[model samples]
Target: MIYQQFQRSPMQTRISGPRAWLAMAISLSLICLSLFLLPFVLLFGAITLGCLVLFSRVYMARQIAKLNQAQANAHQHDHTTEEPHSHVYNSVNIVRESNAKETHRMRQQGRTFEHKEDEH
Candidate 1:
């Protein structure tokens, strides 16, 4: 409906004289230039893509290193500030309880044991 409202009739259309020639010439020149520069354009695009990949890899590596350093600092700070014996005991207990629960659940689901020995 909107397109029909805005559409111009064929009688209103006009392409004549120097303006049409200029438009055709510009388009032809662009086509010729693009054809001539196709190889160069592709090479430049590949180089740009490679550079971007290298830059992203370096940036991600730096970010990961910073995260690891921060995690290490936090871990070190926690150990230094807390009572080690209690923390260690609590962590061990938590791990044991979680392992026990997982084992029990797997047993209930009939997936507890793996066949280690070769069957004849």
Candidate 2:
């Protein structure tokens, strides 16, 4: 509906004198230069991308080695006999404690409101 009432102004189509010639010449020169340098630009881009990929691979290898060494050290220093399920139980207890604290605070602030749906 908004677009149906909208009106656009006419575009200018007339250009004369030296300004028009200058604009044409500049545009043509830019087009020619881009065409001439396209191949060189592509070649440089490929070389740079290859170098970046190689560098990333080497960097990732170094990081993986460091991680492996750290894991080995951690294993050597770990002497606990606790089972993994103990951690889950501990996390659940922590969450319960946090929720209790939040509920207590909310009650103290008199904001303990419950929403109920109306039934016909």
Candidate 3:
């Protein structure tokens, strides 16, 4: 039962700091054995880490923005069917009256949608 509780190490945890630096140090020492290699190793590692951090930050920011937009859309959807739709709240549902306005706008724009069946 005690042995059953133990699991193998995760792949994500495998690519860690000390181990990664050890691997890098070995590779760096093999390529260049000078004492000057330490500064380069540390600098290169820092730059690599900074780039990964920045990339993840940008990706997370976009994801959060998309989530916030979806939340706003949901909130707008909640107010769609209520009376005085635009003038009162500017919510999106706008049952009969808003549809008519949208239709009028579409006619003015001269744009239409057509759905096609996929051959696959």
Q: Can you give the TM-score per candidate against the true fold? A: 0.52, 0.50, 0.40
lDDT of 2 by residue, 16-81 (tens): 578888998999999999999999999999999999999999999999999999988776655355
Q: Tell me the TM-score of model 2.
A: 0.50
lDDT digits (tens) for residues 25-105 of candidate 1: 999999999999999999999999999999999999999999999999987997888884664545434443457878667
Error of 1 at 11 (Å): 20
Give each model's clash number: 0, 0, 1
Off by over 4 Å in 2: 1-13, 79-120
Candidate number of the best TM-score: 1
Better of 1 and 2 by lDDT: 1
Residue 12 of model 2: what lDDT? Answer: 29
CA lDDT, candidate 3, residue 118? 75
Clashing pairs in 3: 80-93
**Cα lDDT of model 3 by residue, 1-120, tens digit:** 766435655655677789898998899887776576889989999999999999999999999999999999986986785476345435343444456787668766996767777743
